[model samples]
Target: MAMTAGVLALVLCVLCFAGFWLGRQEAVRIRSGGVQPHSLPSYYGSYVALVCGIPASLALLIWISAADSLVRQFVIAGLPDHLSALPEGDLALLLTDVRNMAYGRVPLNTARPEIVGAVEHYLRLGEISRWLMWLVVLALAIGGLLLGRRMVSAEFRARNAVEQILNILLIASSTVAVLTTIAIVLSLIFEALRFFAKVPVTEFLFGLTWSPQTALRAEQVGASGAFGAVPLITGTMLISVIAMLVAVPTGLMAAVYMSEFMPGRLRAVVKPVLEILAGIPTVVYGFFAALTVAPLVRDAGMAIGLNVASQSALAAGVVMGIMIIPFVSSLSDDVLNAVPNSLREGSYGLGATQAETIKLVLLPAALPGIVASVILAFSRALGETMIVVMAAGLAANITINPLDAVTTVTVHIAALLVGDQEFDSAKTLSAFALGLLLFVVTLTLNVIAQRVVKKYREQYE
Candidate 1:
């Protein structure tokens, strides 16, 4: 189906271009006959292209989205009554097996006769669905082309029509983005609520212990699991604070030097090289933290008579700060550079030195943006998982000390959802609760940052 959709997209592109050429030539031919074209030749071409592509693309999208559920329904309907009447979980697994067999993921020879028959039926339905989709889509495209050609008279307002369609498309794209965000929030809320139903909200929020293990059988030992989130919250804050301590001064100073002191030619060369840190994958940073920084931190701690765990929050936080340096420096650089030169001139004209002007004038003016960049970097640190997982062990220790092994909310979120398990269980549902907590914390941070930015902005402006 994906291949067919790709081919159909290529075909539509060719057809739309053909429609464009035909419409443009028609408009030109009409103008040559002394009837002035309604809009530009390009507008006429665009009108034809939009007409040829939009309807067919919408149809193809609808068909592809609905195909899977329709296939499953048909396959299930063809199954024997006993097989079809299984519980929802069993039925879902049966359908998965049917799909696996149809796709050759499972060997058919070892399967039951009914399963084999269902696989055959699944293939047949899928083939029919694909062929029908192709036919309907192409027919709509060709029909739209003919209609668009007929409508391309001198009186037709091609530009207005085209612009209206484009406006609608833009609105639709925005709506999709907004809806996706809402959907994510709603899903997290619903699942978190389920987790809360099983584990008391107060206990999960304030309890000091962080175990999430639940026994499989009634007779199993250590069945009751503690779901206190304070430890995870503390670990997250500890690492993030350490990261900010490293990132803020370093990144802000780099920004200050580059934007103010460095020559323009040197700035141009250095800024991109500095921002390249942002492009390096987080896993590589994780590796550096685990193999290089962790050991160095341990040795340095030992050298000073401090007992540092091999996998400690200090290593993760430091590497995470390094990773976030570009986010801070690049934004801060732009913000500092954006401060009007008039302010600097005024400060200098008043007998202030360069350093004094930077301290009293430039930094004050760019405080809002600088704050924003630091907040962005802090958010990046809070959400960092790989470096924490590799450099800081998953102990969920409720400690403020950077030398201790700890885990953040994101690391545990990854841990909780790693293996195949029952989604309804408290162990799995706890991930959603953690996600909700993280979301609230981030949203709170943004709100605080906004208020700070607004207050400073008002005073400065």
Candidate 2:
């Protein structure tokens, strides 16, 4: 795949350069004759480049999509009768092993005589297919370049042609986004429906326990699949609340201090250092939460005569909050700065103190954006997985106590889909249902944020 892509890119670049030079030469000669072309020479050149690049790109995309499957089918058809007579699943695995051997993923020489011969055949077919793809794509690019070069004339509307192609590219980009969103929603809904077929919706929504372990075999022990999700929902909300509790006050205060009181030199240095927290990986936070914070919390609880779980949600939530502090602080600071200096000056002109001016004028003006930052931080809290996994153990207890170990929806989804399993099984399908729920929750938060922004934002002239 990588080799084919590089070759196709080189071909497209060469053809684009050829078409650009040809059209530019034609435009220059006409301009030298004291006749203005319909558009700039550069626009004509761009038009030619687009003509050469677009068709070749589309052909290359089509070839890459189809060639692998076509090659696989051909190889499968020519397999030995005994291998082909294997069950469908086994046969599929056999073919994959043969291909792996051909690609050096497996030892090539240890295979049976039949498998050895088949590996050679698969390699030969792959080589032929790649060569064929390169030929067809390059031919299309050269053909487009020649056609575009012949069509460039003094009266040609190169600008209009370029604009039309630009519009097409924009429409294609928009269509891909729309189609991708629709596909994801449809896929989730489809799998959730499959899950609902085996497990009652009421059970999943209202049941207190969430045990999604179904035995693949009837003879297996301890396979009672309880698909309750309320505990997971409760844990998610608890963690989010803890995170927001920690982030909102501290982040907003930091933003207020930076915007209203701190010196410019100190603010500049502190701001980036604070934002460095956001760039650190969640896995790193997970480690800090588990190795450092969890122990601290446990020790603190013991010192204060309180019981704390080994893996407490408080530890996860606090670290997660610290991780998302920049999200709130940075946005709130920008919004605070966005409040017109005129408002502050007017307040000061009325003999108000600086603190009063901030409290009375700036805070209200920046409230909408501050609210958005908090909501965003909450959403980030709810979506966190690694921190929860490492610090808040996967014990789905429906409790609001921060010191208790609890698991969130994302952790459960990851657990359900960690290893190979049948997609049609209710246990696996539950992940899609959990995903749909998470999507709705995030969507609701965004909608509420938008409504608040629209209604309450302070408009400035």
Candidate 3:
């Protein structure tokens, strides 16, 4: 079946390529006759290729989804009535075992006659389906090419037709991504609903305690599980707040220095180094937070006559902030740079000092982008896992102090599913609940950032 699918894909690819070549040749032939049209020759080629490829690709996708079920039904129909009466899922599993046996991997119960017959039928149906698909695809491609060729006349508006088709194609491509996002959100929602069924939704949302271990057996003593998410949420918010405190001022200042103040040579040398901060792995940042930053923060706090845990929220948040500085600075710098030089010149022309001009004019003009960058950085900080895990303790404490150790949603989720837990257990289900929360938070931040950036663009343009 894999071989047949591969061959069909390869044949379709060749036909599409041929259609592109033919379309281009026809466009060039018409152009050589001094009859220029709306679009370039490549657009015509793309249009032909798209027409020849899209329908066949869609058909192949549908066939791949349904072919196994169709084959299994046919094979099952020929089996004994008793065997056919099994549950759908059970019958499907049995058919899967038969296919495995046919491929000589393993025998399903020593290869009974029924299984052997089903396997034989499966292979026969697969071969027939492949042939039929190939014929249909070839005919479609040939028909599309012939139609395109007939349409390529002296007065034909191939360019407009091609562009309109391309517009639809682009929209279709974008819709796939949008739909995939919707599907992911829906899946998370259902999993979270399952978790809320086991644990009360209000408790998950508002309760302060977060121990997820429940009694395994009915007779277990003193094993009531707490599902309060307040601690995890508190830790997440605290860490993100500390990270933003460190990142926002530093990043904005850096962007200001680079975009408005720095000389060209220094800017050239510094921008790449700043960007290199972004390329460093988060796991490496985890190690840096654990081994270097946490100890330093503890020592510094002790020197200042304050009590601090060895693994503190301050250390993790600060390090994560450093990791995200590049994201904020680089994006802010680009947006600042994009602010028209004429605006700056106009400000300078009014005898405004560079400092005053930047503070009153440039910063206000670039405010939306800077806000977007900060929101983006906040989202990154919230989603960070490794740094917090390595540098902060797993204790879910409802504290506001950065010097105290705390657990975060991501760390809790990681701890829950690190090795293996039963899928139906509350512990495992809690991970999905946390994942749903994380997804929603990040998605909300992204939506707001996009809106801000769009408004900024509109304001300036």
- The whole-model lDDT of each prediction reads 0.91, 0.90, 0.85
lDDT (Cα, tens digit) per residue for candidate 2, span 283-399: 999999999999999999999999999999899999998998999999999999999999999999999999898888899999999999999988899899999999998999999
Candidate 1 vs. truth: CA RMSD?
2.5
Candidate 3, residue 132: lDDT? 80
Could you say which candidate leads in lDDT? 1
> What's the distance in Å from true for residue 411, model 3?
3.5
Candidate 1 per-residue lDDT over residues 73-181, each given as its tens digit:
9999999999999988889999999898888888999998999999999999999998999899999999989989898989999999999999999999999999999
Q: Specify the poorest-scoring 10-residue window by lDDT in model 2.
A: 215-224
Against the hidden true structure, what lDDT does model 3 obtain? 0.85
What is the lDDT ranking, best to worst?
Answer: 1, 2, 3
> What does candidate 3's lDDT look like per residue over 1-461, in tens digits?
66777888888898889888888888888889898856677767777887788778878777777877787778888778888899866787787787787677885457777777778877788788777877776787678777776666657677788778878989999999999989988887887888888899899999988888842433334454898999999999999999999999999999999998899999999999999999999999999999999999999999999999988999999999999999899999988998898889999999999999999888988988899999999999998899999999798999999999987999888888866345666777888899998888898999998988787663455
Q: Give the TM-score of candidate 3.
A: 0.77
TM-scores, one per candidate: 0.93, 0.91, 0.77
lDDT of 2 at 90: 79
Order candidates by TM-score, high to low: 1, 2, 3
Backbone clash total, candidate 1:
0
